[model samples]
Target chain A: MLGLSITQWLFGTLSLMAIMFALMMVFTRSPVNSALYLIMTFFCIAGHYLLLNAQFLAVVQIVVYAGAIMVLFLYIIMLMNLNADEEPRKHVLTRAIAAIIGGMLLFVMIGALRGAEQLQIVQGGASQIGLVKNLGKVLFTEFLFPFEIASVLLLAALVGAIMIGKRDTNINTK
Target chain B: MLNGIPINYYIMLSAVLFIIGAVGVMARRNAIIIFMCIELMLNAVNLMLVAFSTLHNDANGQVFVFFIMAVAAAEVAVGLAILSMVYRNFKSIDIDLLSRLKN
Candidate 1:
């Protein structure tokens, strides 16, 4: 008589898809395919955000992550003209160590999580903090300083990107 | 029997994602793939933050996620530029081949 609700079903499906896509991103031979898989993972994460009622964050995740960042990655991948089998084979030892380290990190984190107290379902009435209007209000008012700083940071990043990416024929000639 | 799912599931899922990202970063030779793995790790953290924010009935976590997204965007721009430059110079983007600085 028990069945998963719409929220549960969505969460389960999205999380599974996210995990699968992430793994594929790691294991796929082609960088372009990996970039595409990353985009899929990002979309799944955005769905998770929506389930949590962080609609604004979800939209931004899609716009910034799936939209802007991923396009940049794909563009770079294309520009480089990378082939599927181009990467030199990693040493077996390196692969083993990486897997072991990853497993240990997961083990430790899960162990720590096991000791935490059981969390009760949040009883707060339908939260509206996720709405763009309310989030914009708080972002501008309470978090105004950080907001300005973020803009400055973006500008700096833009300048830095331009500097790094600009052609320098002198270096090649020398 | 899934009525109200426990918060632990989300935490566990995030942890799994983080681990996958870590492994990808370590195992991948291409710098761009490493960068994508890093992005994956960041997304895992963002998911955890949002889940906690919902649990605590606060919007601050969402705000922080916003900031994180901005930073991530900036990082991707600069990082990919650098990666492309490295590719241009070495004719490959493999991280192992980036040891010319040691010479």
Candidate 2:
């Protein structure tokens, strides 16, 4: 007992789980297993959103990322019949260099963020901005134009996916 | 100070996650796995945005996160479609083998 409160405990646990699963996703060779691990990571992130009191975003994260996007990923993997770990291994030197580069990047970012602790965050008591009603109001009122554009983007993506995924029937007939 | 948990913790967590994703992207040859790593990076950024939203006691950051999710979803759709098309044409999805465009 480090005298930590329940929220702090939960945050620690969720973040640890998230990092572990994310690493597993990367390390696993099987695409299906990688996808499963990524889904677990998404769930942990949803938990963090809940801890942040962003109820709407938390629900959306679960619904969209864990539910829809991951399902699509799995569906594609299955459709392609790529359930095995058939990926050709990269050279050891390449892997080592990538790891070193990533480590350096992390070091630089953490160094830049050293003063983050001193930055004062406003402590607004019992903020309700995370509620659906408040978020919906902001989405519709101030962010209305972007909201509509997102819809159009979704539509374009829908049509484009269908067009790209469909087989070339004309070539087959010839 | 969210329940005595410093905002720095969230920042540190996201930074680590983002690095892991970047490494995965750099090291992996599978296109699907690379795409998943990109998603991981996006989620890391999303976490940071939500944390800042709570820090500022504002909803705007959360709104930005919403738009980001939409864009990510659309991106996944088109990317997967292209991936499947590549598979159909080559009977494989290895990124290294798809280097005909380099010529």
Candidate 3:
């Protein structure tokens, strides 16, 4: 039962942290504060990855989501200098409806899950396939084409962002 | 004790996180905040993927998580650039003010 308690503790704490921060991200008035909370949520998720024995993914999650993507979010927020002052207040009815819809979706998903066969959670001690060596082999060998394609997709996104963001002086003359 | 936690717990956690994200997306008017909510949804999906990967004892799901991360990064780059452009033109990032298409 020691193993069960430890698993429950870790999963419980991580999920609680993740859920709270995600809620804070959504409910917070300031976009900057929302971004900060989202970053914390990412860290909590990365901790879950670590618990699952996916060390490489945990590290990548931090670097890409927390480090790179969040930096971009913050940079945009800073650039725009957004604040709650400009926000149009949402109606109480609209918020209530949204809450009802979201709650319903959660209920449906959980209900569907109730019939599923209980999965025996893998213990923490065993080395699983999430190791870098195993994942790298699979990524480069079986998933090689998709891997290259992802780079291309990233390049396209980079170019598209640059084009869209560039100032067009000709619009006034046109 | 550590290994004995049922997988349903993780799934429930994912569902809760996803619901929060979905609610945020529907309720928030600020475009940037909505975008952050979308990220939360993506992270919830990632958590589910990793949990399943552990269940199946396969690395494929982990690899998929890597792709998802790359795609998310690209998406943020382009999406944020678009948001900045919208702010430049409208002087506001509120979704309601972006109703020029509502002819």
Native contacts retained, all candidates in order: 0.73, 0.75, 0.86
RMSD of each: 2.0, 1.8, 1.6
Evaluated against the true structure, the overall lDDT of model 3 is 0.88
For residues A61-132, write the lDDT of model 3, one tens digit per residue.
999999999998998998988776666557889999999999899889988998999877666857468888
Candidate 3, superposed: residue stretches over 4 Å from native: A1-4
lDDT of each: 0.88, 0.91, 0.88
Per-residue lDDT over A1-174 for candidate 1, one digit per residue giving the tens place of the 0 to 100 score: 146677778778999999999999999999899999999999999998888878999999999899999998888888878879666668899999999999999999999998888774342236678889989998999999999999999999999999999999798799
The pairs that clash in candidate 3 are A3-B1, A3-B2, A4-B1, A4-B2
Please give, for residues B1-103, the per-residue lDDT of candidate 1 as tens digits: 2244578988999999999999999998989999999999999999999888888878898999999999998888889889888887889888988887899
Q: Each candidate's interface RMSD, rounded to one decimal?
A: 2.2, 2.1, 1.3
Give the worst 10-residue stretch by lDDT in candidate 1 chain A.
A118-127
Model 2 RMSD vs true structure: 1.8
Measured by DockQ, the strongest candidate is 3
Cand. 2 Cα-lDDT: 0.91
CAPRI quality level assigned to candidate 2 from its DockQ score: medium
Give the backbone clash total of model 3.
4
Report the C-alpha lDDT of model 2 over B1-103, residue by residue, as the tens digit.
Answer: 4445578888999999999999999998889999999999999999999988988788999999999999999999999999999999989888898899899
Error of 3 at A3 (Å): 8.8
